[model samples]
Target: MKQGTIHNKDRFLNKVADRLNRKRITEEVQLPTWSKQPQYEVFDGLSQDELLDQFVLQCDAIHTNVIVTEADKLNDDFDKVIQDMGGGSIVHWDDPRFESFGLDSALKKQQEQGTDVHCWNYQLGEANIKKAEQANIGITFSDMTLTESGTVVLFSDKGKGRSVSLLPQRYVAIIPKSTLVPRMTQAAEKIHEIAKEQGRMPSCINFISGPSNSADIELRLVVGVHGPVQATYIVVDDK
Candidate 1:
């Protein structure tokens, strides 16, 4: 047994030595010169308007409801979404994009109407986390929307907690038309560029395609197992 172990050890070390001595390939890999880059080809024919339309359509197909509203009507639309979902406690990110539409006033109105609404605290204290976990709805400002996959990208950081999208029974994402990209690759590239410029990437970048779901146990379909069961995307025509 000792002899066999020694032989096997010798064989492993010899293989390691061979691998170490091998020349490393350093040739610059040329990316495919396809005009649409193969991956983004699906977005080639989609116009800006069509991109938004396709985003809504694809979102609907994935069991996610999409609502389109003009910039001026964003406050009304927010009320409509919360009302449609039966007005409940909500926890949302502290993004300036929402503030552009006077979110504070809208939130105050909702609170006055008996809806428990709170913004995520950048401090990330335990009490705030508990509050978010108990909330019925989670609202977030999407970094970008991918038309092809109906995905909403969210960069999590100090003021943006991943729990805001995961702990609640329902999720509401506010997406601006200007942030709509035709493909996921473009979205990823944008993130990469931001990281390069910012010197650091967000701790967690969530690409939510739809509500959390699984069909594993007994091959039975289930929703909200790990996150929100119902997801809504409010796409506003605001640059």
Candidate 2:
């Protein structure tokens, strides 16, 4: 029996599978990109430092303990925050800053101490979906920020995943001052620059304004509708 020649029974199964595949793809295409539903808050002041201060204040107001520290202090602060949040897990990319920021070692220790520290260097959407579906906190990095609108832009490149931003019920993004731009328009231009240099555009560029929110029927406002209940911007101190 030549393997290249399909039997009648196999052909019938293949046709059924093909129809199923088309139906699955059709459902995916019909699914919506979720509406514009975020409780956006623009912190006052213009500088990165100012925005960071306001972010800390907002976190404090929401009763999430603030953990501001030096690069070396990330471990202690991170551990405390994760523990306070009920100790789920932390995930990272292949980026070298995990060590530079001193999070990799601390998180590993936490995992060994009965916490869950899961690391995957690829497929961010799947990773995020997993962590979001199970973990309490999902940690990742960001490419830039918009100080004017108080927006964080997580560039979905080789390592940084967009799901790392969207899926997690609680998202903590590590962004330094060097990547802070002033506006959303600039974010698109930066994307264009990267596209021109890389010969193609990346698959996703996330501009997160704030946690998910909505004003539905009767104009009643509600928060945390589709995404995380909390989104905190942890600005690592360089000094």
Off by over 4 Å in 2: 1-68, 123-128
Q: Which ten residues in a row have the lowest lDDT in candidate 1?
A: 1-10
> What's the number of clashes in each of the models?
0, 0
Which prediction has the highest lDDT against the true structure? 1
Q: Which 10-residue span in candidate 2 carries the lowest summed lDDT?
A: 37-46
In terms of TM-score, how similar is model 1 to the real structure? 0.84
lDDT per residue (tens digit) for residues 56-102 in model 2: 55545443334456776666767666666566665555567777777
Best candidate according to TM-score: 1
Please state every model's RMSD to the true fold in angstroms.
Answer: 8.2, 11.1
The TM-scores of all predictions, comma-separated, are: 0.84, 0.68
Q: What is the lDDT of residue 99 in candidate 2?
A: 77
Candidate 2, number of clashes: 0
